[model samples]
Target: MLVEVKNLSYVYSEKTPFEKQALKDVSFVVDEGQSVGIVGATGSGKSTLVQHLNGLIRLKNGKITVLDIDLSAKKPDLKALRKGIGMLFQYPEYQLFADTVASDVMFGPLNFGFSKTEAEEAARRAVNMVGMDYDSVKDRSPLELSGGQKRRIAIAGVLAYRPKILILDEPTAGLDPAGKREMLSLIASLKGEEISTVITVSHNMDEIAEFSQRVLVMNNGKLLYDTTPSELFYRLDVEALGLSLPHTVRIVRLLKEKNIILPEVLTEKDLVAALLAYAGGRNA
Candidate 1:
């Protein structure tokens, strides 16, 4: 297992008038090579839950074991734990601070104890991994790049450390339609290559449906459902739970009304393939 959370619970402003529970008896396991999506409305504890995986949030009332490191232990090796996980928060591009791309991307490895030469080497590889030419952008300021390029460079910074688990929160936020698709494709390509597991928290149902193999639905800081994307999108009363269905799911439902039933599909490509097969079978 890459990560395991058992009976995890957390409260904000504990023992105060503003006390509010963020997670209640949450439990889940993320296995290696799994692409998991966490979905919920704003303030539903999606972010809070992920923060615990890398020791960003202190564990007060739960058990979490990630990569064989017990998070609830006294003085957990957070630095070591964080070194194996790369986290990109909402608008990760905003986290870029170094004057140059090389400097920014090299920071992670250097901070993790890599030598200067080694850090630069790692930075170069990470930049190429993110699809940017290291030679061309190494000395250039990140602020000079386009929005999408800036986002990729920011991701390269996290990739420099070569984390096994990658967690992205609102990764496609503030991007155009094409940018969103590009970002999703980039993340999809990263799976199983230096990143064995991916945990993404997105408010976009379409993204969650298309990208995730498994889905975790959170409601009011609680894990309401843990199921496949196909099952969650097809079988759940997601709308009633204040969650929107993917556009492809809606299209599938519409086709069903027209007597063209298709199997549960999460992406546009799958929907198209299913429709084609149905039409061909009828013609035969």
Candidate 2:
């Protein structure tokens, strides 16, 4: 396993009246080179859980082993562990403050002790990988770019360090259709190219269904289901947890109710193909 969590639990404001249980015995394992999606409604602890994976949140209880290092250990080398786990929070672009785009992208590698020349080279590669022209944008201010451009540049910053695992929180939020598609495509390309494991938390079921090999559903800070995307969508109570089925899955179900039987579909491309095949069979 590339990551392991056993009986994990966390609390916010532990000693205050505002104290609340944010996570309850959440446990899951992620294999190397696997893509996993996490889905849940608001306040389901999805954010808190991923924070712990990279040592951003301290472990109050339970064991978390990330890249073979025990996160629960006292005085664990958090900096070292974090270097291997690239976490991009919601609106990560808002965190950008460098004078130049290249500087922002180079920040991670430079902080990790890469020489100036090597870091600049890494920055250029990462910027290009995110679909930006390094030569054109390297000197520009990250804050001056469009929303989608800033988001991609922020991702490039994380990529420059070359982490083994990449975790994204609501990566496609607040983007137009085209921007969302491009961003998701960039994220999907990370596996096998730069990162070994990809974990993303999103409310978009369609994106999750299309991207992830495995899916995890969370409800009220509890892990409700962990299975393949197909299996997870098949559960009767999925919507009761405040999540909707992927559009393709719901459409297929509706067709089946009308006796237009078809194999399960998760993506728009799959749905179109299935419908075309069904139509052809009827004409035959």
Q: Which candidate leads in TM-score?
A: 2
lDDT of 1 by residue, 1-284 (tens): 98999999999999999999999999999999999999988888999999999999999998999988999999999988999888999898888999999999999999999999999999999999988899999999999998889999999999999999999999999988777777888898898776889999998999888889999999999999999888887888988778898999999999889987889888889988998999899899
In terms of lDDT, the poorest run of 10 residues in model 1 is 176-185
Error at 181, model 1, angstroms: 2.0
Cα deviation of 59 in candidate 1 (Å)? 0.4
TM-score of 2: 0.98
Q: Report residue 144 deviation for candidate 2 (angstroms).
A: 1.8
Off by over 4 Å in 2: none
Q: Deviation in angstroms for 88 in model 2?
A: 0.5
Task: Provide the lowest-lDDT 10-residue window in model 2.
Answer: 232-241
Q: Model 1 residue 6 lDDT?
A: 97
**TM-scores for all predictions:** 0.96, 0.98
